[model samples]
Target: MSEQATTTPTDDEQRGASTLELFFDLVFVFTITQFTHAFGHEPTWKSAGTIALLFAVIWWMYSGYVWLTNEVAPSTPARRTVLVVGMFGFFTLALAVPDAVHGHGVVFGWAFLGVTLVHAVLFRVSGGDDASAAILRILPTNLAAAICMVIGGYAHGSATYLWWVGALLVIGVSPLLSTARGFVLRTKHFCERHALVLIIAIGESIIGVGTGLAEETMNLQFFVQVLLGLTVIYVMWWSFFGNDNEHGEAALDDLPMTDRTRTALIAYGYCFVPMLLGIVFAAAGLGMAIGQGERQASWAAATALSGGVALYLAGQALFRAALGLPRPWMRLLAAILAVLTTALGVYVAEWVQLAAIAVVVYGAIIVDDVIGLRAGERSSYLAG
Candidate 1:
């Protein structure tokens, strides 16, 4: 294949996220929606596990595209065409997610393979020398994982799960199998791309609230419940957007190229799994709980709502720590308390449980802000 010398952003000319990248992320919105709706329909532990597994596979590839775009901007006609083809693969994957665990595993596997192949080809053709060399190192594992998914698709019963698990394991340790030293890190575009995805994921919670409200009467009680749910979503937005991105970008920028790649992989690639999963679960829970606020929440609904918040807070803490930022004691404490609120839903009204969980998270943000102020820093919850 002829190599296309794509324009790469330099330190002096850092670029923000592009319109094409944002367009690509729209497919991801559908991905999240499908998962949220699936779990909302069957808010059981088994379903949650299936969603988590599929999400890990989908997210790994999705984030790979983010890394790909960070290096080789889809600035050329050929690169743009390849990216759109990848988007179609993602859309197909999302469509299969609703039935991935039940019956459509083969379809899911094929779609994933298409997406993976597109990633490898695009990197090789447009990524220039350094990125092309770096992609070659990780390409085997990427292809291996996709093959595992294809095998898992044809698998039966427990064997199916086993094959998918193998795929996850292969992709999970990819960084260890290959060195990250050959890739370039454009901190600005890298941070912006991730931030946009995170924001879009968070938007799923709002969609959840709307879906939950669809069948209910818009009474004063429903309005209050909506407000409380939105509050939780708002806090989720604030937690990351309120300076975490800046801190994360700055932290990565300070590191050497190789260390920066590793840290970005851990901080953005791995840490974001929990955060995104948390959003998925929380959206599922909130969608289930909204209209039925007066009644006691089902075990699945209660756990999904509160546990989702806990997962997000814990993930945020890990992200901060990976960036060598000060430990978020307040967020950690909130994670514990968020988990404890699961009992509230089981015992009390679901709205009451949601309110309590919201308090826990909002309180953490407030405490962190106070601490930041006291330390003479800006009012950033993650500021040391």
Candidate 2:
């Protein structure tokens, strides 16, 4: 527990993000904001799908960097310098995200490639059998993504989009196929960081919901609606950060190197599906608050809230499944809650009623903490 004893992360310690690493999240915030703007400009199902896919593709790149940094952070001074430069690459890529879909999109493509080059170079310089081995696992995938982005820049239209999307599917998956066993430090750090970053993202949704409600005219009516928004935020808070999350993180932290990496790769790494779902939920709630609630809102808004709740539950289910526990009631309840609220939001009259429906769904999410969260809390899982 002493400071000296904590000098270097061991094979067991969970390595969440450092403060500096957290600052890196600012880039992704821009990425998410860019997607939101793009969606607003052309709010079609296709646009939504495209935006989600693109956001996901960029997120994967960030994930790879985090995974590697968690394991080993450029141990020597020279390598560390390259990493600092890579940070700039991340910022450049983020700045270009808004234009990544078109127009001189090569800025994004080049920025993304530059970041990958940093990782590839890091692998070469780590000078250890283990430190650099996992790099190869991701090399092909990263290269594929890099190539697709760069090529798509010139190709334009559906051909370009399809090319990038295909590349993302392949790139997103290749690292999991990595049978490399030497990435203990990298995997452990990545898993722990995921727990925290996941929280950060969830936190952003809470902020979005609050700010959304706050932007509405504050009167007795708005007061009640704000309370309703806060309540939903509370529900989301409990579902993601309560005992279930703690237990799941503990389970992952204790996993063997390969399992730990796998848990992070496909299962844990995949938790962002819910995180984005949650954000969209908040955005829908925000939209409803800002008087975009004509037609009593729509199926989409309702689905956003409900789907978010479901994704939160599904994340827990996947986490437990990875940790060897298989209870699925939370996920089931989450899906049910989502369906209920979505239906109610679409059918209800008045903003107050929508708020009321959200409350009911959120209340269910809170109750799950008491009932369904027990199995996870009592489980023998805890990442090292």
Candidate 3:
């Protein structure tokens, strides 16, 4: 097969997410919101598990595009067209999220399959034989997953879920096949793209708060709840962005290609799933708590509220570990705090629970910042 040189910008060419890439991400903003809403509507163990499974599917699809864009320059007409169509496919997938378990599973499957095939074709066209061959090795795994998705779509109840699991299993293990030949990840663009996606996920949490409270009559308590929610979001943002962000960039920039690939795969690839999961969970909790207007939370709602924080903090810790950085002891502590607060949530008013969670997140950020500051103005990996 003849490989055409792609006009797509590589790390050597492009430094940050392009305008078209940003446009591509807009669809996912709605997709993440849909996931949060789905969980909010049915806050149960079963619902949570199903949504988590669906999110993995959704996240993997988007991440493939991110990797594609990172490798290719979007300057070519072909690449641009591919991106535009992929965006529509992603939007269609997002639309199918609410009813994915039952009625609309086929629609979800087709959209996902379209996006996956598009990514594979584009990667094949732009990459050399080695690259094409790597993609080829991985293609079967993706196709297998897509097929399972189709089967899952047609099936119902437990059978549908089993097929989706089959799909995820194929996707999860497939990456191992191509691990020996890592792909190019323009450090700056790669880091920025992932960061932007996380920010979008955080935005989803805020949107969740707004949607939840939109039904309530305007009052001081409503404003207070909104304020507290925003504070918690801010602190979460700070905890991730304040110190961790630079270290991640440094790791990507400084590490050798094989190490960089491994780090990217482990940290950004796998770790982000839980982080996104946590954000969605937190958003679901916020929506429930705010909508109820300071009512004492039901067991499900309280668990959603605190469980979300625990998951988020735990995801952060894993992200740090993946980068070969010092583990985020404070975040681990916060995760523990989250679980404890969740336990406390059962006894307290919903608002009190929200406030307490915010305090724990904020305290973690403060502690982490102090430790980083005390470590002093050390140079980043970029300096070398």
Deviation in Å, model 3, residue 9 alpha carbon: 11
In what order do the candidates fall by TM-score, top score first?
1, 3, 2
lDDT of each residue in 1-384, candidate 2, tens digit only: 001112233643644556666666655555555554454445456766766676677777777677656655544566567777778887777677656776756887787788888877766455345556657656777888898888887787888788778778887667656574655544445655665666666556555555545555566766665566666666665655655555665666677655666666666667665565445545544444434333465655555555655655665666656666445565566656555666556676335445654666566655655554454444223222
Candidate 3 collision pairs: 8-72, 8-73, 9-73
TM-score of each: 0.96, 0.82, 0.93
TM-score of model 3 vs. true structure: 0.93
Sort the candidates on lDDT, descending order.
1, 3, 2
Pitting candidate 1 against candidate 2, the one with the higher lDDT is 1
Error of 1 at 67 (Å): 1.0
The lDDT for every candidate, in the order shown, is 0.86, 0.61, 0.80
Q: Encode model 1's per-residue lDDT on 1-384: one tens digit a residue.
A: 365655553542387888999988988878988988999888888888888999988999999999898888877788899999999999999999998867899999999999999999999888878788888888889999999999998888889999999999999987766778667888888888889889988986797669667779888888888888889888888877786777788889898776888899999999999999999989888888887848999899999999888888888989998898765666788889889999888898999988998898888887786776687655355545
Candidate 2: what lDDT? 0.61
